[model samples]
Target: MSEMMTRENLTGLYVITDTTRFQRAALVESVSEAIAGGARVVQYRDKSDDVARRREEAAALAELCRRHGRSFIVNDDVALAIEVGADGVHLGRDDAPLTETRARFAAEGLDAIIGVSCYADRLRAERAAAEGADYLAFGAMFPSPTKPHAPGAPAEVLGWARERLGRPVCGIGGITATNVRDLMAHRPDMIAVISEVFAAPDIRAAAEALCHAMAADNTESIQTTEDPETS
Candidate 1:
């Protein structure tokens, strides 16, 4: 196993790729721009059945993330993640069981950073935490263009998970720079975005704006929580 990705490494902007938005070359270029603009984590989320192409793209992304020293995760494909040596894998409800995936990683001598999608279910988040998920993701924080039908999760869930689950929490779906401050009120460790960054005219600029927004919010949150008298 390479360096294990701890919960501490799960912070900041997390960008998810949309195959519908970009082809292979464009995908690589756009992701490079995102990383350059301070995306700490990148997830390859192709749902197509093209095994060879998926593998190729995932391998390319894994290498790109490795070069940049950013965490790379594969969505819902343990085999592909293992093949590409990804730092982690993200599991949705329909995906493989977390324990089985962890066993597979152990068998392969990889300390996979597995993240579980809890949607709006607190019980499900608790279960995932108990089952050893490295992080918990909740959303459709807003109406997601990419997954419009995805279940809507309230921003409060992000705070709840961070307090109770003892793992990093990610807010995903439809989060953009404009409304990110609203989500930031819940203080999510990371925000997972798709179309908001990748669909923009300038991917790097969009990513940078989001990162800057998040940082500003975090600064405000810390200051608000601190005791001025103590200072």
Candidate 2:
């Protein structure tokens, strides 16, 4: 991981969610619970075209993350991220290029943290690193309810990315406590979750359990495995 990402001392849980799924009270409640359960990053991803609402939700999430001493990231909208004074923004491939994104944030004096979604391609991951993205994410590792039709990324790609990108790498999609063990060997800097936390019956416990699994010591076990599918 780059010294920039490592400097934050962030590990384990990162939560991404939409505003409609969580009202004000529920959003605050869930965030409080997740932070208490060890979430170090909270990403607000609202795909709606309603700019006003997106701004509102981003501001709220940024405030919550700030209160908890965690990083707040706005998904897909660099403008909204700046408007809300968020810690950073997460960009998809189709979004603004990292160079432009960084320049925009820097112009605003934000020093924004930028993360790119590289899916499962090593080349794309390498490109993101070269572009100075603070982190790179891959997955839909399992059947994710948020994006069910999204193809899964191989678990071992995490190792390939860790070696090449040298930046914090995140695994997203259908991550959960039960199957997260599959990703342990890759040693990602963190895991980005959606329904696993908000949709859980007990958000706090679910967050805690997932963080524990990610933090478990399984380096030897994963390396010894004979999965030719992995790099």
Clashes of each: 0, 0
Cα lDDT tens digits for candidate 2, 1-231: 011333364456889874667866677788778888888888888777877766776787787777667888888888888888887889997898899999998888767788889887767888889989888899978888988898889888777787756888789999888788888777888899988888888889988988887777445334434354633
Tens-place lDDT per residue, model 1, 135-216, is 9999999999988898898887787778777899999988999999988877899999999899999999999999999988
CA-RMSD of model 2: 3.6
Cα miss at 217, model 2 (Å)?
4.1
Residue-pair clashes, model 2 = 0
lDDT of 2 at 87: 79
How far is 130's C-alpha from truth in model 2 (Å)?
0.5
**Colliding pairs, model 1:** none
* Residue clash pairs of candidate 2: none
